[model samples]
Target: MRVRIAVPATAANLGPGFDVLALALELQNEVEAERTGEAGISVDPGPGAPPELCDPARNLVVRAYTAACAELGAPADGVHIRCVNRIPFRRGLGSSAAAALGGTLVAAALNGAPWDEHSIIDFVSGLEGHPDNAAAALLGGLVVVTPGAPAVTMDVPEELCAVVFVPDLELETALARRVVAGAFTRADAVHNAARCALFIRAIATRDWPTLRWAMEDRWHQPPRSALYPAMPELIAGALEGGACGAALSGAGPAVIALVAGAPEAVQEGFMRAASRCDLRGRSFVSRVRNFGARVDLSA
Candidate 1:
């Protein structure tokens, strides 16, 4: 049996929500797995691909495959895996989550795909160390995750769209997290909670005006601004260009913009902001993908 699964890239910790809300984009990482004579993995090669990303042994796909194989306790054939990745690494996009979800889906499918959606979610969440990005990758669109013994996800509206300005250089998530302080004051916590609630409401209602005020976050962004000097400028530029709200997509470098009207125009505005900053990269004007990971057997 041949299993091909595609998982969308996700942007987690949108604005003030911290690890709560995540948006899954249309850009994807595709994986195809097939049974071979022995238990091993194969990955396609490329000129510009990082050596770390190319190694199947240490790759997320192989890790997920090994995990699923261990769970099943069944061994018969080797696994041949092919990965086609478009999303850049360490740029605040959920490339790791996509790779993990894609691998797990293929593993389960190889075993007759017995595990249901919830189990898959739990599995991927465990592997990724969080549910926000994994949940969105597994079940796309806007997802709110409360991580614990068992994770829960609520599907958000598909009509909503996002604009992200991805910078050229990579900003490590660990490095970004390290810059943040360990604790926040009571007042700061309250402010973040209130804004996060308002952001959720804005998404639920699609109220563009409310979102402008709601998406502001003082918890992460304030301290995190030191990491990316261009962030403040991007936020100001986005608002100036008519974006309803803008925030750090995940950690840094990529600015997530909430737009009310035309996506193309909004994207162009973000592009202008990038140009102003002397930043060189692409801007993705994307809608929330309602359909998460799916297997195309034809592949």
Candidate 2:
């Protein structure tokens, strides 16, 4: 038996929503898994996938799959999985979350295990040590992950899209998070809280103009700026190029801008700004996907 699943890329924190909010993107990573006769685990990192992803024991997809198999009371070994990775790893695009979700979904499909979506989110969150990214990947669209409650999810309008700038660099989440001082100032807390609420409201009401200020953050982005000194310029360019709002995507090194339409301007904005900073990078536009993880095929 074989199973194939697809999981969407996610952008977390959307500015002040730190660790509480995220949204899914159209970008996806796919996984194919099947039981093998051999008594061992095997992983194939598909074309363009880095060697880092090919490690059977360490690859996130395989680990997640193995965990799910154990949960189903099935053998964890004797399984082969091939990962076709589109989301860039370690770029704060939730590639790890996607991998885990896809793998788990494939496992459940292969084993015919009864599973629920919420539980999947909970499971993946446990693996990733955070809820925002996996929650968005599980529920899709814009989500507010609340404890002891279902995530508040909203569907994005067809017109709104995201412009992403990815530098030829990787920012470790641990390193980026380490820069933040453990304590928060009352003023900063108040500031981020208000902006976080306003951002949700702006998206809910489709009040695009207010997003210019709504996406402001003081919690993670400010402290993270030290790592990506060019962040300010990239955001400035996106805004000047007509984006409603722009901010660091997840931890650092990459930036995401929300725009109403005609993403070309924002795309160029990212490129031009990166050039000015001498930051070698690429830019692309992606839709805010409403659908989350799904089984694409099984046999």
Candidate 3:
């Protein structure tokens, strides 16, 4: 049996909603897995995929596949895997989430085990240590994840586009996360709470002006700015370039601007900011993807 899976890229923690909100982007990574009737795993890494990822023991996809099979009490046998990775790893774009979802779905298909959205969410979130990115990759659109609660997904505004500026330098999530403070003051907590509430309403009502303020945060971004010195200027440039809102995407070296106008304008704004900050980066213009991971079976 052969299984193919596609998972959308995700941008998590849109400003004040740290670890609670994420959106699926049109960028994607795909995986193809075939049962080999053997007892080991092999991989063919696609374009832009790192050479080290070809080793099954070191690969997230192969690891996820093995874990899923164990959970299902299914035979863990030979599987040949191929990856077509468009999302850059460790760029705050949920590449790991996609790989985990792709591999788990492939394993479930091969084992003929029934799977559902929540089950996938539970499994992947357990592996990822957070639900925001995993929920967005599995369910799509704008996802709000809270601990001990089912995630809620909302449609992204049709006019809104994401202008993502990805730096050439990579910031691993572990390193980025280590810089964040473990505790917040009451004022900081309240500030983020109010903004997170406003952010949801602003997106729902399509209130661009409100969204601009709602996306501001005192919780994560400020503390993290020390690590990505160019973030403040990049965010300011996006707003100056007519974006409704902008923020550091996830634990980012990559930033995303939410714009209702031409994405190119925002892209250019990011370039200008990069120039001013003496930073080098690439930009992508993308729309929200309303659908999540999917699987297909072929002989």
Candidate 4:
């Protein structure tokens, strides 16, 4: 038996909604898990798959697949997994969430367990140690997640595009979190609360201009800027080029800008910022994906 799962890329903590919000992008990573009815495990790593994911013990996909097998009473022997990676790893783009969720879904399909959205989200979120990315990767569109609760998702406008500039820098999420650990003030909290609300409302109402201010954040950005020092310039250039709003994509070395109009303007703005900051990066323009993970099954 073989199963295939495709999970979308996600940008979490969009601006002010730190750890609470995310949206799915069209980019994806595909995983195929097969039960070969043998006694050992094999891994086929596809193009651009990071070295860390090649190991069975350390691989999130393998680990999650095995975990699900144990939980759902499925046979784990003779399993073969192949990865088709596209989302950049450790770039604050939810690559790990996609892997975890992909593996679990593949395992469930092979096991003949019923598809359960909440269980899948919970399992992947446990592996992720956070909900925003997993929820977005699973549900698509824009997702708001509260700790210890189910995530709520909203549809994003089809016309809206996001231009993401991923720099040469790689900031590990743990290190980035450490940079801002326990660093929230009452004013900072209040500031983010208002901005987060505004950002969500603006997207829902199609208020393009309001996003310029609505996406601002005083909480994680200030401290994380020390890590991704090029962040401010990148965002500034994107806005100057024509983006309605811009911000750090997550605990990012990648910056995401919302563009309601000319993508060429936004791309040029991103290039100018990269040049000015002396930072090297590439930009990706993708529409928000309203649907999340997809699965295919075969004999």
Tell me the alpha-carbon RMSD of every candidate: 2.3, 1.4, 1.1, 1.2
Candidate 3: deviation at residue 83, Å? 0.3
State, as a TM-score between 0 and 1, how close model 4 is to the true structure.
0.97
Q: With candidate 3 superimposed using the best TM-score fit, by how many Å does residue 202's alpha carbon deviate from the native?
A: 1.1
Q: How close is candidate 3 to the true structure, as a TM-score?
A: 0.97
Question: CA lDDT of each candidate?
Answer: 0.78, 0.87, 0.89, 0.89
For every model shown, the clashing-pair count is 2, 0, 1, 0
Instruction: Give the residue spans of candidate 4 off by over 4 A.
Output: none
- Give me the displacement of residue 283 in model 1, in angstroms: 0.7
Model 4 has a clash total of 0
Please list the residue runs of candidate 2 whose C-alpha ends up more than 4 Å from where it truly belongs after superposition.
181-183
lDDT of 2 at 81: 92
Q: What is the lDDT of residue 30 in candidate 3?
A: 95
Worst 10 residues of 1 by lDDT: 147-156
Clash-forming residue pairs, model 4: none
lDDT of candidate 4 over 1-299, digit per residue (tens): 88889999999888899989899999999999888778877788778876766778888888888888888887777989999999988898988898889888988888888867777888788887888888999899999998777788899998899999988778999889888888789999999999999999899899999999998989898899887778999999999999999998878888999999988899999999899989888998999999899999999
Where does the lowest 10-residue lDDT sum fall in candidate 2?
Answer: 290-299
Off by over 4 Å in 1: 45-48, 149-159, 181-183, 297-299
